[model samples]
Target: MSDVAEPAPSLARLGYSERWKALFAPMADDDFVPGRVMRIDRGIATVGTGAAVVAAEPAAHLVKTTGIGSRFAVGDWVALAMPETHERAIIEAILPRTSAFVRRQPGERETGQVVAANTDTIFIVQALAPRGPNLRRLERELVIAWDGGATPVVVLTKADLVSAADADAMREAVGAIAHGVDIQVVSGHTGQNISALRSYAEDDATIALFGASGVGKSTLVNRLVGADVQATREIRDSDGRGRHATVVREMIFLPDSGVIIDTPGMRALALWDADDGVSAAFPDIEEFAHACQFRDCTHTAEPGCAVLAAAETGELTDERLDSYQRLRKELEVSSARQNDKLRAEKKREDKIFSKAARRYWQSHPGQGGRD
Candidate 1:
């Protein structure tokens, strides 16, 4: 027999860090495979393992025990089991996530949706063409991104369409609202200032692009990837909305740097679990809150409330406080609704299990079954 060892390309190219290794050590053995989820279509996920990109279905036990609604999304790191029959690879288990981007769907029904998982940074893109800019929407996106535990970088696209002075003014206006976030103005057509945006993506990091429709998110993704990975379209003359160019969340690896996930443009980004993000995004208001006489000051009508005092002294804008209070109340209501839904779902599942047990006992007449 030849004395040569085959290269373990999969393990070698995984390039997991010490932190990731420790995170996975408790859940994975030495022989367990590691991969990053690149795309999720329907229920099947395409994972990038070092050996090759493989299509996989989550294990049946994982599917049954964990709600599919809350499990494995695009950009998740997962553990894989060797294929038994050389036909299908099984996603044995999902490694714990470092961060996830989640939002509540806009509708009568109360439901939370996970947009992406394990993202390191989020690029909040907004177009400066057609209309100047939607400051309110930009603020909302910032809050959601901050809450997701990722650094939010604002990308103001369509700079070539506007005059130089107009672009500077728009950037200044956005910078005022953005507070401490980094903002870049780039034109996909002219390739202006694209390098500033590229500097964020380094090795072993993942960045996600999020923006409203017609904001040139897909176009920017195409430019960054240096190829037509996503479809692009022009916005309507009447409104700033463009056609839904990207329908799914997919991850693409850069030539030299890390991965980027492009998502469908969101029209409504309702907040879900964003209390910390709200505080971080509105640091001015938070700083004022610390000076309040009472620790629990609502800042609405309380005397000695530093927030109201700031607004009166022109240190804080009334609009800013109003937006902050509105988002806080929305988060409160959404959290309560989510808890209620979870309780209701649990009760429903319990009832179904009880009924099934009764039916089984009736059929067998002497069988003892427990859930």
Candidate 2:
């Protein structure tokens, strides 16, 4: 294997097409250049301009950043201020994204972190562990991916560990829940179906990887890239859980075509603004709701509620309906909390403005006679 991976793709090949060209054309200020965010680490961003992937900091105004969720994501197209000297470039502006994979900040109400932006497709990588894929978790991931406006494909890794029959059984289970989506079972180590994963990103498309820790995202990334760009660890023998290997979300330019954003496994994936995603992911439930007696049926015990009827009659599995209800209820509670946060912020701002206004009027008592 080559110690060095292939060089990064050109800006155009990095999905910097005419749309980006038009967006950056307006801000054609001297010394300002277009760049894509490769990765962000410790207050510094690795931005890949056409020329080079340089260490960059956000323009002073954009700096008060916290984590990956607060600022530029892995796939953001940005405008950078590159000076003549050896100083790091400045990310002046983040161009509008075609799609954004946003999740609620874990343990925080009313805050969102965009996992990746402008991804044409998102590979929901779930390892086929000895216990099998977690159906409920897969459902939640589908909701977020559907809501993010990216084509979601389920890639089950570690096929070599399980028998063919077991892998087939697991794939069928996943297929049942992952309705209307492409599903692939592959061994990243053995290179089984790796080419199929590559086919999704043809013609300079961008793909984002999302999954929980110990799912072999890092191993798959290294295999897909055909280089040891990311680290890998073995799963625990006792509990069958793999250790976390990837730390920062990094973007790599594929030698074959397009770019891939490899992200660290998430411990928690709370929903942000995924109401539409819920409907999209659960089309069958939505279809049943449309035929219900009342428009706002919660699918619980509502009389003539088609969803409940379906669940009772074995048309829809009880477990699946429960998952759907849980997600809906979670979204409802999250939405309320987010609204409350927004209201409190507005009130605080208003109080501050009122105090400033009162002080100005008191200080300039005679000068306030505009009438």
Candidate 2 local lDDT, 86-178, one digit each (tens): 378888888988888989887887788898999999999898876678888899999999998998999999899899999999999998889
Question: Candidate 1: what lDDT?
Answer: 0.80
Residue pairs whose backbone atoms clash in candidate 1: none
TM-score of 2: 0.89
Candidate 1's TM-score: 0.85
Counting clashing residue pairs in each candidate, in order, gives 0, 0
lDDT of 1 by residue, 1-371 (tens): 11111332243233356766777676665466777777888887877767667777888888786442447889888887766564556788887777778787577447556788878889999988878778988888899888878889999999989999999999998987887999999998778998887888776578899988778888887788799878877545567654687888888766567678999889878887789889989999999999999999888889999999999998998888888999889998988987898899999999999999888887887556543
Which number leads on lDDT?
A: 2
The number of the candidate with the highest TM-score is 2
Segments of candidate 1 deviating more than 4 angstroms:
1-15, 65-70, 106-109, 234-238, 342-371
